[model samples]
Target chain A: MTSYSLILRTAARFLLPLLLMFSIFLLLRGHDLPGGGFIAGLVASCAFVVYLFAFDVAPVRRMLRLDPRSMVGVGLLLAALSGVPAVFFGEAFFTGLWLELELPRIGEIKLSTPLVFDIGVYLVVLGSVMAIVMALAEGEE
Target chain B: MSLMWSTEGAGLLEWVIIAAFALMCLSLGLATLRLLLGPTLADRVVALELMASITVGIIAVYTISSGVSDFLDVAVVLALTAFLAAVGFARYLEKRGHGDD
Candidate 1:
């Protein structure tokens, strides 16, 4: 009643790696591609889906060592704060702005604050699902 | 905004639509299957939560695809309301589940 069978636990264990990899792929391609942070987050939350299935919510929560909603709050704050750079540049809020640093060895790599915001969104979504599902799963136990 | 405006009407835009539609269908189909077949109340809750997140992803893609960030408004609404729905469903289930016992 408290934990999943061995087969399910194994499946859950393998699920996170696959999901995390896919989430990163989606996030990296977000700007020009259809994939993005929110989708990536949902994809990543598949790890939690497996965990909730593999173990009881309380045990999994203890292992996680973080409250999912609080994690979501941190994500939202980071995302919102990522917009601050726009204000510094006198651009509107949530402006898509970036910086390019050309290193002699590393080549021209472009980085954006928007990307950070997207990352925040990704975390927010994953955390949200984790929190909500944990509550429901707890009830089940 | 600049990205979308600059990339407007190219083959890439069409490709974006096709890929998004493909993923949307795939995820939604899976979610629907779980919704229909999920044996336990907790299973249904988890699946529905996934569906909500999927819906948000679709909306975000649509927001950029349609070249109107207005869809973000819809995304926000979905995010806010979806959580409320989860809470309500849990409470309702708690009551009904105990009643069954």
Candidate 2:
């Protein structure tokens, strides 16, 4: 591997967390807001890409454990689950519902089917981005 | 393509979307070039990743432009399916037990 150690280490330590948070923010605010799950996931995955490029894909994969494919499956399941409620409510498929829950500590954290959908979106994005990357990375190896 | 995009006229939002789309196209193109010309396999993978990011961005932009949330589903599937495949391949490489061979 090439030596650019400092750049790689710094990116993993400092840059990745911020990137992940930004991704979440984008996913959460996506409905009626400026961002969504797909964009957010890519942004988050970019951080991982930095890690993969800097160190190597093997260490990172081991560190994360559970192949990215599993996450992809989970994401798909979650997204589909999010839509099921619509059918139960006598609405057409994917009829999104927005609700709110008032919590004592965190105040009112709005919850909705859309948010659930976003979570699924986040997972899928995270999974797929990693999927393509790992495949290409290994192909090269 | 311009005609389709310009149906809404040159509003600020329209310009922004257009610019963003153009930028994504450029990035994807750059990544494709790298994938084609890379001296190493890893470099090609990285380039492929860069391309994927742009593609996802384009999806999001289109979803927003259309205001039809239905498009979001497509974006979700694309992101998950493609990324997972990448992960599977990575493990196959790691399991080879060939670390330094």
Candidate 3:
């Protein structure tokens, strides 16, 4: 992996940001559009995978401060907690709740508990994938 | 008869998706063959990766054909994890002979 050509490294330098943005776009649009948190998280983690391919795992670990295993737990907690609010409101668990807000630059934005759930799924997927990739990469070393 | 074709007639997008699906299936078949016949572990790993990628393509084609956008999530997840499988195999190969002691 470290012996990759200079061309690939240069290409990745530009491609990484574009891939991240596309993943975020997928995450945001997932509620109403073709994109969603699961796919977006996969895309985001793959972007890191691409980075790891071009470089290595140490920098990626540094960039992501927390352990990937912890990320998985945090994601699960966030997803479960997203449903708890609805339960407290006398709604069934995991019921979708919505909030409408008007922001200056973004204009009208709609938020929902499902979106939070999706975000949690995204994080879990990303973290788990990275954990596997990192563990394998470490073993190789 | 454009009207008649509506029932049996394929739209451009439909045709494209169908063509892509066929190509993916073809590749998947070839990958499967290689996976079965490969003499080396590395060749088998490559074939496995190819099959996984073709599966992703099949999922994408199904998404378009069925007009179900959510399957894209499945495709993305598959694509992401497929690489991990590859990495894991590679590591296993690295450790196979050297660490036996």
Candidate 4:
């Protein structure tokens, strides 16, 4: 077994949630800002990587609950599906469709197909990177 | 060089930013030298980390100079990557039995 450091483990535990939150924030603000799915996914995967370094591959895999390959598949499907609604509307493929909703608490909210696509990209990146990282880490043992 | 000394529109903040940029560039050059010349793997890793941090700082300074807050996200991601890289290197060193602790 690889030797672990208590300081590293403790830091990882504290950093995991913060990193995940920041990644989500990046995803949410990505539409108009510099943040985006690719960077967000990278950050999220880095969080998992930190955990992997502190512990082992088994626990990291277990914590993920779903296989990374499946995540990639799901992301691709979502990205493809996001463009389908445009076809139904008699528009060109991958045309951006937007919806505005009014809510009492949060006021008006704007949603778009591009946002969905971004989420898909986020998932694909996160999954692929994790898959590679986990495979390499497991191989080391 | 002209922008650094020109007094037409340059303010105190701009001067400070220019100074920061110069210092960051100097540090970056020094870190690169260490990364290339360090005798040990640990020293090289530390130099790499320093370079990464300087990169983040450069991004932040650019964002401020450009008046675009979006680049801060880049800084954030760069910082995260640097931290992960450091952790990964430490783990690698530990596995190779070079860990000091």
Off by over 4 Å in 1: A103-106, B1-101
Clashes of each: 0, 7, 2, 0
Q: Candidate 4, B70: how far from true, in Å?
A: 2.2
Off by over 4 Å in 2: B1-101
User: lDDT per residue, candidate 2, B1-101, as tens digits?
Assistant: 34455665647778899899998888888889998898766667667767766777888999878876656655664665455445544444455534421
lDDT of 4 by residue, A102-122 (tens): 999999999999999999999
> Per-residue lDDT of A1-141 in model 3, one digit per residue for the tens?
335547657866776797789889899888767778887887888888877776779988997898999999999999998898788789999888899999999899999999899889988999999999899778776
lDDT at A55, model 2: 71
Residues forming the 10-long window of minimal summed lDDT in candidate 4 chain B: B1-10
Name the DockQ score for candidate 4. 0.78
Q: Give the CAPRI class of candidate 2.
A: incorrect
Candidate 3 C-alpha error for residue B25, in Å = 4.0
Model 1 residue A31 lDDT? 81
Lowest lDDT 10-residue stretch of candidate 1 chain B: B92-101
> Which residue window of length 10 is worst by lDDT in model 4 chain A?
A30-39
Best by DockQ, which number?
Answer: 4
lDDT of 1 by residue, A1-141 (tens): 532358756766776576678678878778876678888887667656666666667666776677888889989999999988898899998898878999999899878987999899998998999988887767654
- Compose the digit string of candidate 2's lDDT tens values, residues A1-141: 334457546656776676677677778878876678777777778767767765777877986586899988998999899989989889999998867788889898777888887888888888887888888877765
TM-score, one value per model = 0.57, 0.57, 0.70, 0.91
Docking class of 1: incorrect
